[model samples]
Target: MISKTTIDQVYEAARVEEVIGDFVQLKKSGSNFKGLSPFTDERTPSFMVSPVKQIWKDFSSGKGGNVVAFLMEHEHFTYPEAIRYLAKKYNIEIDEIEQTSEEKEQANEKESMYLVSEYAQKYFEKTLWDTEPGKAIGLTYFKERGFTDETIKKFGLGYSLDEWEAFTQTALNEGYQLEFLEKTGLTIVKEQTAGDTKRFDRFKGRVMFPIHSMSGRVLGFGGRILTNDKKAAKYLNSPENDIYHKSKVLYGIYYAKQAIAKEDNCFLVEGYTDVIQMVQRGVENVVASSGTALTPEQIRLINRLTKNITVLFDGDAAGLRASLRGIDLILEQGMNVKVCTFPEGEDPDSFSKSNTYEDLVLYLEENAKDFIQFKTSLLVKEAANDPIKRADTIRDIVNSISKIPDRIQKEVYIQECAKIMQISEEVLYNTLAQINKKEVNEASKKIRQEQKVFEVVKNDPLVEKVDVQYELERKIIEMLLLYGNQKQKFEDLVLKENEEGELVLEPEIVEAKVYEKVYLDLQEDEIELSNEQFKSIYYKLIESLNEKEDFSVNTFLSGLNQEMVSEVSSILMEEEQYVLHDWERREIYPKEKQLGVAQLVGETILTLRCNLIKNRIRKLQEKTQDQHDDNSEILEEIMNYLQLNKLLNAKLNRVLS
Candidate 1:
């Protein structure tokens, strides 16, 4: 467990803009910074970070939170993991509170697996340098492959000792449980005759590559055996476990994520060496599928960084066939896919190593083809002198184009495809329309089935009634957040009798801070917010004011949980965006709601009280209509509520019919 003091230090030292800037390219927009949202695919920037509030908001996805929350959301880190990451980044020393034996035993399964994987990573790296066989074999193999000492350390390359029980014994001596070791595929266990287990290392005699999550935590390892054992597989990977899913993990993502976003493009390769080699050669925005078939989940992972993927393949027949299989999946994700084929005998790893950086880059620029052009040209050659084959090839190209979500992009591709295939645009349009209509009908059927199931549950009598005052209560909370500490005088209407004995109104100004006025008004009216979230925040705000003479939003935010912080950030950031838009420059002035902050606060409380009283009057009338009840008290309460409601309505300028 991380100590609370260490967590506080991390939060205090880490700046929101600096922490989030490592992943997204932020540009200055007035007081806040705006950038393309990493959470969604878009050209226009909607992600905003406010240094003043120590929080960020993505208007596109409606996700707003503080620095810690951003790490947890963006990188899939746990709360403690995110804290530790920030501490490491800011160079803060962590003082951990050790867990008890029973507490360790009762730890979450997924986290235990993660802990085991991390320990194994450190163990492998240590063995690679300290052990005799590791240094002679593992270190030599990496150097022979042309990896520099810096690159080896950057990727956390390591080696496991050739002995059977070296790693397993060391892990056991360190008090790691056998169950987690077996689950993480770090130690293989076999039952013995004496009811004890025999354990062996899984990556024995192999050089190790630690695959990391986006936050740079070790998820699993890919091991390559050095000895020429014909019977054994050349490469081995960890089995599917709670912490690591092979289909969702991308090799070198931890190192390449920033470069990918910065370049606004990603280079997709086929192996770990390819990614490492390309990155080492100055093309930093590159990742690989770890030699697995490209999955939709993997494509979506790259989609988070950028929408453009350029597949690098050796110009071999089998390699080109394999690379073309993934283009449709990329198109389905609404991403643009381009293909760059190297010389017939080379891959990213070999080619990057053999050629100069400028030569390799120039070659890629000249040869890169859009997916439609690549697909059309490759297919047309095979379909030569056969009309039936030519027609089928055209349909296949149209199918890929129809999978694109953007209508503008689809139209553009269709025009290009028609020109290449020597077909009329009208024919291609009709084919695309038929495909779209079929897809729409299938989607509509699925949606209707889901709605039928949802409607049954939604119509249940157990559903609670909607509270009408929820919006008014939220308005009060919003006002306190925006103008809580400011001092303002509010005009209270005073009713007096004139010479004619008719009631007349005069304005009396009473001065107080917004927080004090809001608290006193709510207390006098005996009103509480009906919404639970707003009510909880109201009390927290009051407690904050009581604790400090001058309240700062950043200080108050430090005490809130993740959910509350996100809520407060969303409220605060929405108003900031409005101001940054600067509508006044275009001769369109937006009304300043905060200019009458006192009036807004007073009106919010008054409206809530009036609504609550009207509800009470309604209940009283229902009781007065009951046949079995004594109705005199209910009738009197209803009459008094009616008079109070009428007065409130008059004050609000509502005509009573």
Candidate 2:
């Protein structure tokens, strides 16, 4: 187990905005940060991070928590893994015991696969540096490709041995399971006709490139064969498994995330070496598609960092035209894409390797053209002097423009395209309208078909009915969380029988901590929160507030479990989402919750009392109707509750009827 000291140190050092900003593109909204929800598919940003509170909330999926909870949810990390990740990111020394064999055996299958993959990465690196075949072949190959030793090691580039079953046997000897090795595609296991198992390294005799998740966990590997064998494929990737999906993973994202966020643009390349070469040349905000077709998931990964992408291409690329279609996917994501090409016969790998860093940066800046301009220029060459082909090209560009989600951006691109092709804006607009109409018709058809299978339910009255008690309880908790440590003067309402034998409420002035006032009011009435979660949090919050002279929401949250942390964060951040819209700038001023803390606290408590009294009155009337006997006592009790409720409502300025 990790030591308490280390965990507390991580909590203190890790900033919510800084950590979450790595995964989501956050923009400053008031004092907090807001971004698109990573937990859900959303166009509008519903995820919020409060640096002050050290907590985050996703209004889209209703998930909220502190830093650790965000990691666990977004990265699917176990508690210990999340803590360790934070520790590593913040450069804190972890104090913990190593897992024993028995403890390692207790890990789940996906974790086991991760362990095996990580172990394989280390084993390969060791072999590449320490062994004869690794140095003579693997090291020689990378060095020939212009990679320095530091660059190779920084990317964890390694070499797999040539001998069949060499890695498999060594892994088994080290007590690593064959099951996980095979599952992660490191070892290939097969059954022969003699009923014996044959095992071999899947990436035997290949130079290794370990693939990592956005959080930098080893998920899989991409191996390149050095030998010129006609029967063998040039490059092989790890097969689709539980943890690794090539379509969803972008090479070098773990390293490029920071630079991409800093530069506000990502450099997209075509191969692993291309990314390595560029980063080695001091261009950090770059990633590769790993030679696959660009995917929406891959685009979204970049989308989380920035809204701009500059795609690099070889001057003589055979697949240049084929690759142009993928740029449409980027445009569809509402990202501004620019295409850049190198000199003939040179790719990002060779170009970055040959040119000085300044020259390379200059070339990219000078050559990068907007997707519309690049597409039009490239396609215009193929359609030269052919009126029919020119019209088709115009429609193609319009189709690409239609993929953009922003109408203003689409209009801007269309005008640019019209200027380039020397075509009238009206014709392009008409073509765009036709394309949009077709798309909407197809979407409506799909929705209609889905509606047939799924019955629609509407107008459920209970769905709309406000749960006054629950809201009051929630409001009480919100007040306690926000103003619990604050000292304020309050007018306490004391119910009593007056000289005329009528129930009346008299205001008694009192000054105390907000938490103290809430606690005393609830204690005096002997009222308990009906919601179990709120009740537990209520007591824990009060205890924490009473104990700490300098209470912190984040520090207090660190002591609670994930569930309670989520609940408290959601309560605290619900109003923060509204604050993100800057309503004051729109000339709509909202009532600030902090300004009337004392009055809000009193009103919330009084509302709770009123709700409970109404519930008691309801139960008493039921009893009077059921018994039909001497319900005089119950009736008198009900009358007294009604009078008290009336007095409380009157004090609250609420209509009794």
Candidate 3:
């Protein structure tokens, strides 16, 4: 367990915007920061981080919390893991008690794989620097590739000894199970004769490049053999494991994430060396496909940072053709992709090594072509002097354009393609239309099949209705969070029996804290929220207000678990987002809620009271119909509730539905 002092130190040191900003591209929106929702696929910014409150909320997914919670939700980290990540980010020393054997055994499979991968990364680095064979072969190979010691260490470059059991034996001696070892593909385990097992290292005699997740955890490795052995593969990567999916992982993302966000553009290369070499040469906003085809998941990873990606091509004809396929995928994700080809004889690794940082950047900027231009120029040459091949190329380009989600972008690309192909714009549009129609039909069929599966559940008579008061309960929580401590004067309407023996409303002015008024009103009406989660938070807010003069959202959130933080964040951010909408630009200026805090707070509590009274009346009417029940007292109480309900409805300007 991490000590409380360490956790507090982490929380105080880590700023919400600064921490989330590393993973997300956040822009200043008033006092808080706003960015596209990393938790969901969104075009507009719905994820908000409040620097003053030191908490973040994703309105789209309804996930919210402090910095640690964001890491857990985004990275699927455990509680202690999230705390440790924050501590590491902020450079705070973690005071953790060692885990027992039972605790060690209780770790999940994925975490165990992670542990093994991390251990292997460390072991490889030590071997590369500390051992004779490692230095002679592995270190020499890296130096030959022109990677500096600092660059290699920055990217966690390592080496595994050539011996079969070198790494495997070390891991076993350290108490790591072979189960995780084989699972992470670090140890190759085989059954030997006489019911014994044989284990060997998977990456023996190879210079290792550690693949890391966005938050800098070692996921796996990509190793390249230095020896010219005809039988062995030149490059071998860790097999697909619980922790590392090659298609989903991007090489050097850990080192490049902040630079990508800060530079507002990601530089895409094809190899691990390309990314590291470029970063070493001061081009930091770069990542590699790790020699695999680009996946949508990987694009989405970059999409969280910026929409603009400039894929650095090796300039070899075959390599460029292979990388072009990912451009359509990038377009489909609504990202603006550009291509930057190095000189015909060079790749990013070779080019960066030979040129200065300024020259390399200049070359990239000068040579970068938008995907449409690059595709047209490259393909048009292939279709030279052949009309049929040209026509086929045009159709191919049209199909790529159709994959784009944004209509405006599709139209713009259509125009650009038509002009370059010297074809009429109408031709491209017709081709795009046919492709779109086919896709729509296919999508409709899929939707119909999915809908049929859910139809029975939708029509089930046993489906429970949502609680009617949830909205009001949520609003009550919102009010308390926003303006609970503010002093306000409210018009307290009192019901008195007049000479006519009828209840009359008398208005009286009362001044008090908003929470004080809300508490008193709810207590007098004997009302409580029906939703257990909302009820818990409502009381916590009140208790915090009662105990402290200065209420801190961060401090309040520290006591709650992730789920409660999400619930409270949803309540608070729903109001914040509602307020953020620029209605004034549409000539619909909304009245600020703070201008009528007393009325807003009073109405919220009154609405809750009104709902409770209505429910009571419903039960009373049901009881009145019972043949064996005596309901005289119930009817009298119902009449009093009805009178109070009318006064509340009048104040709210809401007629009973």
Candidate 4:
């Protein structure tokens, strides 16, 4: 468990924008920051970070919470893991007590696998530097590849020993379970006919490359075999497990994320060494697909950092034509992609190793070509003297352009393609239209088929009715959260006999804290929030506001559970989402909620009272109609309730029918 003092230090020192900015590129919008939603595939910026409140909300996914909750949601970190990550990021020393055996065993399965993988990485690193065979084989291979000691250690490069059971036996001896070892694919286990189990190292005699998530947690490993065993594959990766999915994991993302955001571009390559060599040569913003085909999940990981991707390719790569298709995926995500190839005999690794840093940087800048230009040039060469092939190539280029979401960008690309191919713009536009129409038709067909499987209900009356009480209660909570600490003048309504002998209501103006006025009004009327979550949060919020002299939303949020934290953040940030659009620029001014806090509060209370009285009147009328007895008293009570409801509605400027 982390000490309370250390947790407090982390919360105080850590800035929400700074921490989230490492993963999601945030831009300044008013007092808050806005970015693409990491939780959803959104082109518009719906994810908001309020530095003032120290909270973030993703309107697309309806997920909102404090800094700790964001980590837990985005990175899938446990509560303790998130706190520790913050502590490490902010350079706060953690004071932690060792867990007991029972507590250690209580960790979930995924966490256990993570711990085992983490231990295996350390073990391999220790073997690389501390043992003889590791230095002789693995260390020599890396050094020969032109990697420095600092570079190797920075990426956590290591090597597994040649013996079959070297890693397996060591992990078992250290009290790590064999089950987790097998699960993480570190140890391969076999059961014998004699009822005994034989376990061997999975990456035996291979150099290790640890693959990490965006937050630098070791999810799995990529190992390269050194021996010339024709039967064995040259490279192997950890099998699919709960913690690691190869399609979603990118090599060197943990190291390259900051640079990618800073440089505003990502250099994509084909292998682990390509990323390392480029980063080592001062080109730090690079990631690898690990020689696999590109996936939307992988592209989205880069999308979070930047919208520009420059793919680096070897000049003599055998699968160049096949890999060109992957560039279409990038374009589909509405990202700008460019392709750069090295000399005939070199790849990014060899080229970076051979050239000086300045030369490498200059060569990339000069040689990089836009996707349309590169594709047209390459395919035009192949389609030389063949009209049909050239026509197909033109269609292919147009197809790629059709995937872009922005209409203006698509049109610009179409014009460019027309110029490069010596074709008319009308032809390319027609081709794009056909492709788009086909896609829309296919999508409609899919939706129709899905509709056939289930009954479609239209305009359900129950779905259309507004929950008036719920909205008013939500408004009350929102007001309390935003203006509870501020002092405001309010009109207290007093019902008494006016100048006449009849009863009438009078208003007496008074000054008090917003929270105090709200609390007293609710207590006097005996109104309790109908929603359980709102009720629980309402009392806690009042208690917190009353106890603290200096109120902080971030500090107040720290004391609530996850559910309460989400509710409070949503209530507080509801108005902020609209404020980001800068609507006043269009000469349309929306009323600011802060300008009339007192009026808003009083009106909301009056509305609540009116709603409650109307409900009472409704029930009394229903009882009088159902019962044959007790007619006079029920009728009188209903008349009195109607009068009170009318008075409250009048104060709210609401017409009662």
For each candidate, how many residue pairs have backbone atoms clashing (under 3 Å)?
0, 0, 0, 0
| RMSD (CA, Å), each prediction | 3.6, 2.0, 2.6, 1.9
- Residue-wise C-alpha lDDT for candidate 4, range 288-338, written one tens digit per residue: 999899999999999989999999989895777798888999998889999
Winner by lDDT = 2
TM-score of 1: 0.89
What ranking of all candidate models by TM-score puts the best one first?
Answer: 4, 2, 3, 1
lDDT of 4 at 395: 92
Using TM-score as the measure, name the better of candidate 1 and candidate 3. 3
1-657: candidate 2 lDDT, tens digit per residue: 987778889999999999999988999988899988887766678889999889999998999999999988977788899999999989999876766767768899988898889889999999999999999999999999999999999999999999998899998888788899999999999999999999999999999999999998999999999999989889999999999999999999999999999999999998999999999999999999999999988998998889999999888867888998889999888889999999899999999999999999999999999998899999999999999999999999999999999999999999999999999999999999999999999999999888775543334443557789888888888888888999999998777788998778888899999999999889988999999999999999999999998988888898899999999999999998787677898999999888988899988888888889988998888888899678889978888788788888899898977
User: Candidate 2 at residue 182, lDDT?
Assistant: 94
Candidate 4: give its CA RMSD in angstroms: 1.9
TM-score versus the correct structure, for each prediction: 0.89, 0.96, 0.93, 0.96
Candidate 3 structure quality by residue, lDDT tens digits, 525-578: 777778899889989999998898988787778778889887877766665685
